[model samples]
Target: MIDQELTKIKSSTVLVTGGAGFIGSNLCENLLNNNISVVCLDNFSTGKLKNIQPFLNNSKFTLIEGDIRNLEDCHKACENVDYVLHEAALGSVPRSINDPITTNDVNVSGFLNMLVAARDAKVKRFVYAASSSTYGDHEALPKVEDVIGKPLSPYAITKYVNELYADIFQKTYGLDTIGLRYFNVFGKRQDPDGAYAAVIPLFVKQFLNHESPIINGDGSYSRDFTYIDNVIQMNILAITTTNEAALNTVYNVAYGDRTTLLELATLLKKHLVSLDESIANIEIKHRENRAGDIPHSLASIGKAKKLLKYNPQFNISDGIKEAVNWYSKNL
Candidate 1:
């Protein structure tokens, strides 16, 4: 069972891989908000320094430009780090489909490098960004940790591989580790212009510019879109948890609710319209579904609830509302 007040480690030193990306940057902010010392590492493959520019001068923070795929870089970043939050990866199924070699190099080889560095450096705990895509082709309504399906894409395979490697590390190397299989996470600082950008940010940007946002299918596919804050909470919990049962396992981190693409567009339009009424009439176009895209995804976070005392505070609508507000202010 999870303790209500998890054991708090002295945040004297912490390293976050991909700390300049959407979810990673949010985690960095929350840790800093708690007065924790943060060491951020990124190769700028997708992460931008501007995302974490506010923390540049903070005495508690240090930025290291490094690639996780390189063992030397990982070793340098892991030096004296108390906790390691691994979030570096080339995300998005379409992107992986377009370039499987790059995705494999970053998500697999890079992840392994980070794990080796954490182990060699004797870090307290390793917490990595897993994905709901690990649930893959399962037709299950609510995804659970124990049950899984065939991987549907290169991206999904890589995440599942992360969990597998983490488990192996625990058994073989006596390394403490935890994996959070995050659902579709979105919030402030999510880049809205990339070819592989997430749905919420991209749609918000398009709506802001009065451009038609394309829905991959007929707009009926659904997802359990989680918030970045919730993901941060899970990382904090995973790193802080002292429960032996929870230390070496993977948990679903999500809002436990599903929303369809059509419903998502509707909600985005409503939020954008409230901010700027001119966006109300923005159209959403539909096309053939993209390959490697899951039809529907919803996570069963019971394991997280029981093991990590995980509590998610945002659903899709609330998250969307917050994300829209951020984009409105930032973009």
Candidate 2:
């Protein structure tokens, strides 16, 4: 889609709200690679300076240190921006469970602030990161966008509220919007040191150091485990699509496959073994299941493929191998 679809945004300027973070930094880098001017707004709460440091010297890349929880910051970031890719949020089930107040402040209230700023700025499109957590207690395989269950956690509630606010923003204020429900996005630059670190990078880091990585449950739980590039494709398509029917809706951004926790850990170990033979001997351990944790998560990407031409290029094996390689060298 790069030489074709992404060409549409080549002349446009994009504002990545969390451009110092993992997924946001990747998006910012991709846009800058295409010679598209990018303005990055981040407070470095969960974002890191190292992530955006490489782009600091680029003339086309601009960094605005600001928080999404502040409306002035949102307004300033949206100014003269052609499109907004909102990726700023507090992400993690346990984090929200520990402090629902801060989660709602950033995810729900901050999301609304961005919506209003985007509307007033008259940006062409507002594309934000939604999550599969919205699938919640719904016991279904290959989660579809239209169907959803009650939120299983405070973080899930906040993300669901983002979708609702986006929908109302479009209907009430004529602001076009699209939500990409990201599933387990992991890749280079993803932090492995946080208490809320995602499973993939965290596991890869532990294996690199010959530390046993813990599985939250008895290893029966599963996830779609999407790659960062697939997510980048979905975000680009969300902004560039000319399909009138695609706007004001949500789409699942995933590789459309699932891997059990046991399978995922084994996959990580297998790939990291190449870096250090000792990594093979590292044991995989398990404990009680995490609260707000679902047994499985899978996404049906039919909506994205049909509407946005989103074709995921990485499967679990391919994604894990790439992630392991990057972390081995960078982590």
Listed per model in order, the count of residue pairs whose N, CA or C atoms clash below 3 Å is 0, 0
Ten-residue stretch with the least lDDT total in model 2: 1-10
lDDT of 2: 0.92
Top candidate (lDDT): 2
Worst-scoring 10-residue span by lDDT in model 1 = 1-10
Q: What's the C-alpha lDDT at position 191 in model 1?
A: 91
Q: Candidate 1's residue-wise lDDT over 199-226, tens digit each?
A: 9899998998899999998999998899
| Whole-model lDDT per candidate | 0.89, 0.92
Q: Using Cα atoms with residue i matched to residue i, what is each candidate's TM-score against the true structure?
A: 0.97, 0.99
Q: Measured by TM-score, how close is model 2 to the native structure?
A: 0.99
* lDDT per residue (tens digit) for residues 1-331 in model 2: 6547778878889999999999999999999888889999999999999998889999999999999899999999999999999999989999999999999999999999999999999999999999999999999888999999999999999999999999999999999999989999999999999789999989988888779999988999999999898888888889899999999999999999999999999998888877899988889999999999988999999998998888999998898888888888898
lDDT of 2 at 255: 98
Candidate 2 backbone overlaps, count:
0
Model 2 spans > 4 angstroms off: none
- Mark the regions of model 1 whose C-alpha exceeds 4 Å error after superposition: 1-7
